[model samples]
Target: MNKKLIICALITFISLPNLADDETTLSGAELINNNCARCHNSRPVREFSISEWRVIMPHMREKAHLTGSEVKAILEFMEIASSPAQPVEVTLAKSLTVNPRDVLTRYGCQGCHQVQGAGGTLGPSLDNVISEKGRAFFLRKVKEPQFNNSSSAMPQMPITDDELEALAEFLSSI
Candidate 1:
């Protein structure tokens, strides 16, 4: 009985962090959908490039009086929403190894995204996105960001399958 209690407690503790992350992600999406649209027709994420978003977010953040987390969330959603789809490369290595953080930085993800509370405010936080959205979702988003949302402005990244897998795994662990 003591063992069972310990296991249950462990599970609960482990689960709470993920649950919090999911809530934050959802709230960010909801806030953008509900609030941004109230003032203006919610533009598709594809409406602006990442650089353009950089300029626009600060002004909008001040105007809306959005908190840091809210700004982070909005930026996160926008990064994914604005990415354009690209054809997957056929010449990738069978098991190309990669460092996810390095890849992210190399791709300038930090310019628009916040990971572990560090990065830009142009996109949503990537702290627990894999757990919240799943690896498949990240795979699709990385390869073809506009697959589900035609209006996505997220730029297509030229990454291999192995890199994608590494990134998904890294994000899941986060």
Candidate 2:
């Protein structure tokens, strides 16, 4: 009996990782495609954070008539998708074609102020703003332009947190 117990413990220990990896399969993808996509087109899983998803799922659950378990599965998938450690450079590179300048254009940022010789002159040039203000400050400004400065003319950019982070990373590099 002692020998049998030892063998069983070893087998279970060895199989734990395999079980975890198997659990990570595209179950979330299927749930999103079958349930979430019924109402609207599929969205990129990494677009929103887990906390945002927690808030959003309840609203969507009622609309889609999803059960609690379905919401849990979708949240699990998004948590993995938007994990902080996921390399942002891969997505940024794919979109920009290795040119950070495209972010400004894509976000309509070029129409306001010049940064590397493109954009309107209504706002101050961002030649050294990144260096001066730091990335966190820059992100705050982008998210809430008129937060502190009442006279600030910049509009609140309608962008996801992921895009804002990518834009900030690109801006800081420039």
Candidate 1 residues 1-174, lDDT tens each?
A: 556556766665654434345666677678788777788776777778878876887788877888878878777767655665443333323333478887888888878888888899877788877888877887888799799788876789998777778777777887
Residue 79 of model 1 has an lDDT of 68
Candidate 2's residue-wise lDDT over 1-174, tens digit each?
556556766766664433246453356657789888876677776667678889999899988888887777778767766655422222223343334455677778878888877778888767667889777788889899998798998998777676776666676776
Return the clash pairs for model 2, or none: none
Q: Which candidate number has the best TM-score?
A: 1
lDDT of each: 0.74, 0.71
- TM per candidate comes to 0.43, 0.42
Candidate 1 local lDDT, residue 150: 87
lDDT of 2: 0.71
